[model samples]
Target: MTEEIEQFETVLGFQIPEPLRTVHNVHRWTRLGNSDEESIRSIIARYIEYRRAIGTDDLDLLRTFRNNGNVECIIQYLRQSIRPMVVNTLDNSVVLICQPGGTDFHALASLFTSRQLIMFYAMLGEYFFQQVITQEEISGRESGVTIVYDLENFKITDYLNPYSPIMQIFRIGIALLQEYYLELLRNLLVINSGPIVRVFLQLAKVILLPKAFEKIRIISSSNMKERLLELVSSAALPSAYGGCWTEVDVENVNPLTCCTIRRPIEGKAPPCNIEAAEHVNLSAGKSYSAKISATKGQTLRWIVKTSGKTEFAVTLYDSKGKGEAELLIPRLTIATPLPDKVPEVGSVECKDTGVYGLEFRNVNSSFFSLKIRYGWVLE
Candidate 1:
């Protein structure tokens, strides 16, 4: 009995508790009895139906069976028709019977841990039972395991087949549910800044800004002289109008635009052409500004096209250091149409926070007049 119980445990991954083992031994003894096997089969069929009446479908459970009212009557009939025979099988052999008493039946449920894992198993078990009950064409011959076990002959004969239509339907239902939930979780993990921004802007339109345009807050502060140009000049491959407010993933190289509002330095005058030179040669420690009107979120870009061996350092601010702050000039260099590489964006921690501002430095030589053109974007 112990060996047989262990074999069942190996296959099911669960141990057969005490009283249940005793029931199994009794059932085995009855099977090997001298009377015809038909009587035993009839009792089993009646018990199965009684169990089905309540909520359970376990073929092994003979009493306290389903809540259905018919099981008690069946049990009474069995008691009268065939005396309850308890068999004692070989030491290592097993006999299937009904266990009337068991300690800690509820404790066995602990094997199922998480809610999600429990639901998964329940779905599979339900599918299996439903299939076996509904399918008509599935035959015992096609199913590998013989359904009924005949102890007298020590053989199992054809009884139930697992390939029924019921099982197939169950599988299909489970597959569909899995796919639906997986897709939902996938969408949640991916961040879509574009749509999120659009929704925010639309909501702001109705609540904050309405009827033409009123005084609004623009993040521009020149209070801090230290300038940091977050975005540098790069290939302006994107078309002017169509590319506004679009995002460029940091992992890749792309041109980002920024807007600068500037005024003349205390003593210095405006550049000569304002378009061609692309380079600025100003006295060290001087300040300058140009009239700027840019929507927030737009990137500002400066292209340098200067001749001679001179480097220019420029600073950008909102209102001469009074409002929100930004970094305009990240580094000092003579390179124009800035290289494809860009400094890391700003962050809250400091390493590379995306704020753009001005940088200060001296020029090696001086030029008569410098030309500058600036563009901004709201992305």
Candidate 2:
């Protein structure tokens, strides 16, 4: 592998980036039939060129994003709007499932330009890759992931139109995945496939590498559960896919919110540390507020679960009253707890020293009060 890496750099006329020089990645290249000098050189060259084109060549920048919690920040923002993609992990494989019908593409396009969305996707992919590699190091084994694409309700029109936002973003995302993470793909299971899915596969054949394309399997809804069980255990697979796992909220699915990290980095803070758990009775047409002092650079994390859907927001006020209070997280509707009892969780990094107000409002017209159990921590 060391000799192959040296030859790869010699052929490319420049040394590969430090992040791509990992033993796992070198083995991935070799496993993907890049052992020959010419093949290895060609694959590495294309990967480097793609990273440069996408402005993600600076792996250090991605590391910064991961360390500063920017990756989770972007994920939270996306979850509030659209949630077509959900990620989970099995024994040695990460599963990424996409449901095209779950997204509001028009709203997504209005919220973010194509470039912004593409960049976010790239960053998320990089984070996932990092996590997978870290797990490999810990387990002393190679790892890859499965992509389960559920096209049960996908609209062919939205995908076929060249000018559509969905089409534009989809094409770019596919290209990026193929160029950058093709070696990480164990197999792609297209479940609930139909005629439209077949058409899409035809298009994918053109975009995906021959070996990558061969990893795809189309499965109908009837036998999807049985077939998937062969690869993923009932404990790890979501119930929606014919498994026993029901922790994820399928109705309001978001990978960041639904999935738990298999192996959290040892030194970093957990996503949220609850310092207090208290209940509040919010009367109908009224609100409840909790205040906490936070300094700049500290992260404020909270989890709220109510008897019913409620309005929630966060505001930052000047500790000395020298300036007006700023709304950190705007008022948004928080859905009621799912059947699995997963609470809605959120966090934001403080940019100024101030008093942060976490407010919950009962918007229901009923005269009864809403019972809420909430927890928060500042770290």
Candidate 3:
């Protein structure tokens, strides 16, 4: 070991100076079974100070040693001879509380080179690679430097490159640690546990992506509005829909008054059925040029054709139900129509609003179906 000490300076390209040499001698004596517990503990204290001087932590150094296996035997001797006494053996397992913020896997691994701890180092690597590296090619099962739990389950990541022999050695070492730990780690000390949990949770969110997007696309504003209109139209059919307007209040004013018919009866028919279907919506804004003819006893009927069932009203000028010019039609003028003038329907903005509901007369009676056409400037 002393002969190897001379070569250490040559390999490291720096002389093993005073305090460092003293610490290393004490460290070697313990490994060689020549030092007492007190002397080894003193060496640990001095080694800690030396580490602080170099501005590195245990975790950092361990990772570095793992990357470069040059000091493996020396580090292994330290782990076997000194590290066990330094640990805090808890009820469940050992807890290595790094000095406040001074503890790191690299430094710890560099100091203690036990197989159990080496496997843990691999796990720690796996955990960090899973968290920090999102690139898919770099995070695969066959990746060179790997972290393995069981045979099948492992996180293999690329450390550097295929050309670099240093990286190759590091990868082999990590793989060896993984294989060795599988056989040795009977009681698992959690390695990279936090980041692993986080990765799995993030994967769960990605798995649920399609369903989330479907909900968004279906319920968007434009689609929702169209869906609403379709539903309203479907539910608006006569057998289903009671009426367009709800009767709120009714008021009776005068008995009779002078009334005049306004607007032309513009009509239409749907594409298919023409039997009980000839519908018409009367344009209520303009006066209709209608030709009215009547007789005595041989009842006169002025039929208004429409597309569907509709509500219409009629009013007579200075006449009541049984007056001189009384309305004696098919159903005797349905409801109370406007007296003097009819409410305008077609406007500039909307399509049309006149007398809307019109249909074919079911009975083939010789009632002259008055087909009047009128137009208005849609406002």
Q: After superposition, how far is residue 233 of candidate 3 from its true place, in Å?
A: 72
For 105-137, candidate 3 gives per-residue lDDT tens digits of 223322322322333344333323222222122
The CA lDDT of each predicted structure is 0.26, 0.62, 0.26
Residue 295 displacement in candidate 2 (angstroms): 32
TM-score of each: 0.17, 0.53, 0.16
Q: What lDDT does candidate 2 reach at residue 234?
A: 65
2 or 3, greater by TM-score: 2
Model 3: ten consecutive residues of lowest lDDT: 252-261
Which stretches of model 3 miss by more than 4 angstroms? Answer: 1-82, 86-167, 178-181, 186-379
Question: Who wins the TM-score comparison?
Answer: 2
- The candidate maximizing lDDT is 2
Write candidate 2's Cα lDDT for 75-149 as tens digits: 433322122212344557656555554445544443443334455666656655765676576676677776677
